[model samples]
Target: MESDLLIPLIWTVVFGILLTLGVRKFTKKQPTNKRWVRPKSTDEINKSQDE
Candidate 1:
């Protein structure tokens, strides 16, 4: 019946959210700096542009 399908679908969604939160909690707390680079200040920008 539709109700049976709905119940399983709801449970699946709940389980997915719980799993995502659990995995996030288990991972490291450090910020990911590898993908980011420091931005140049105005002086650095002007110097680069002057070169």
Candidate 2:
């Protein structure tokens, strides 16, 4: 009984930590400028594809 509860509690903590780290890793901005890349609108994408 205790073992069952303990196993899940441990797993929850571990998964929570991993999830937090993953979110932080992706959310961490590296810095960028228009020279590297820029966002394109849907219309631009459609126009480019048509050409």
Candidate 3:
């Protein structure tokens, strides 16, 4: 009875740690200026110029 509960409790802790690390690794920000890559079309540029 105690072994059954202990097994799941240990697995839960291991899974929680893995989940935390996986999210930290996968959701990390890349070093880049994202705004500079998006070029405006001529029409869009002209519209902004008119404002």
Candidate 4:
């Protein structure tokens, strides 16, 4: 009975730690030119239509 509780408690702590680490990794700063980031230029729409 005690072992069952212990296993889940340990797993919960480990999972919480892992989640915090993963969140930190993703939230950290990176180069602004990364593909997922949108460009700041408002002229992009105009330029695209002219193409």
Cα-based lDDT for every prediction: 0.91, 0.93, 0.93, 0.89
Clashing residue pairs in candidate 2 are none
lDDT-sorted candidate list, best first: 2, 3, 1, 4
* TM-scores, one per candidate: 0.53, 0.54, 0.51, 0.52
Any idea how many clashes model 2 has?
0
Task: Give the C-alpha miss distance for residue 37 in model 2, angstroms.
Answer: 30
Top-TM-score candidate index: 2
Stronger candidate by lDDT (1 vs 2):
2
Estimate, for each residue in 1-51, the C-alpha lDDT of model 1 and write its tens digit.
699799999999999999999999999598766877788899999999999
* Residue 8's lDDT in candidate 1: 94
lDDT agreement of model 3 with the native:
0.93
**Model 4 agreement with the true structure over 1-51: per-residue lDDT tens digits:** 699899999999999999999999999987676477676686987888899
Clashes of each: 0, 0, 0, 0
How much is 44 displaced in model 3, in angstroms?
49
